[model samples]
Target: MRLYVTPASPWVRRVRVCIDELGIGDRFEYVQTRWPHAWGTRTVEMPADFVEATPVVRIPALVADDVTLTDSHSIIDYLDGKFGNHRLLAADGPGRWKAQETNALACAILEAQIMRRAELLRIGADRSDDFIAKMRDRGLRCFAALEKQVPSFGDAFDLAQITTAVACGYDDWRYGPAWREAAPTLTGWYDTVAQRPTMKATEPAETPER
Candidate 1:
């Protein structure tokens, strides 16, 4: 299997973390997608190799023996089905639904942050006070809701934690570490999550040129 990813991407990081946690890193090759040092731009030409390969040009696309899957959630769902004993997504019932729901919310938080950051760079403004306050408030609200719900997911890493960690990690990387001050419980949760080998290995750092 080949996993195409961009190091700074939370979506791609989620997949890498999943593969690492499953102790199956050797089963897949990780290739860097998106040009190095290129920011806020994407070129969407299907490679001659993958012209019939897949319809998507996004990162975290997984190429299995005969199948190509895009979207991190779908890719993880496939992995969980094959290698997970109902670990990432619950094996049955409402638990699966809830996990999916939480994952969606978490993704939204990350998406909003990404868009906000893009806007910041585009306009040559760090971040507008009103813009940031709105985003921070939204993130905190999501964080609070997750904090109350995460305890029920039990000890081992779950989808909720993966999404939460990636979102918070992104904030730390692109925004400021002071978010730890605004969301302490979430920050503490991240600290514990970061101790996992997968999280440690995949944690995003500013690209060398940045």
Candidate 2:
């Protein structure tokens, strides 16, 4: 199996953390990708095979045998099913729905953070302060929602927790500690989860632009 990744991507970090938690890191060959400074402008030059594996050109793409997964959600779902026996995430029942709900909130936070980042990276004149403010507010709103859900997180460290932790970590890495103001409970939970070896190993960094 081959997993295409970039260290700076919270999406790719989620998949990496899931693989490590499942103790299946040895099962994959990691392929590194880069983000060009002209990210939103022109085509990115990625490996031919990676392009073939995911025409949409997203990172965290996984190619295993005959299966190709182009997104973090699909990759994590496949990993949980094939290597984790549904341990990372529930396979059915009310637990599955609950996990899905929490994951949705976490994923939304990640989306907002990433979108905010993209906007921030734009040239001064090209950037939209309104959009950036919108994303920041959206992310804070989701963090508050997660704050309410934290008490019910239990001690499982499942997919929902992994994704939430990733979102928290990403915000810290890219946006600093402002989010902690809105989600103090989540802030406490994340401080401990961030100590996990998997989280430490996958910490976000700058991906060199092309």
- Top model by TM-score, which number? 2
Lowest lDDT 10-mer window, candidate 1? 35-44
Residue pairs with backbone atoms closer than 3 Å in model 2 (clashes): 36-210
| Model 1 C-alpha lDDT versus the unseen true structure | 0.73
- TM-score of model 1 relative to the true fold? 0.82
Q: Candidate 2: misplaced stretches above 4 Å?
A: none
Put down candidate 1 lDDT per residue, 1-210, tens digits, no spaces: 988777777888888888887777899877655433334444444455443444555567888996789888789988988988768778789978887777777887787786666445544454476775677777767766666665565576887778878988887888777567656776777888888888889988543332
What does candidate 2's lDDT look like per residue over 1-210, in tens digits?
Answer: 999999999999999999999999999999988778666545768778889989999888999997999999999988899888999888999999998899999999989988888788788798899999999999999999999999889788899999999999999998999999999989999999999999999999998666
Alpha-carbon runs more than 4 Å astray in model 1: 36-54, 123-136, 207-210
CA RMSD for every model?
3.3, 1.0
* Reference-based lDDT, residue 99, model 1: 78
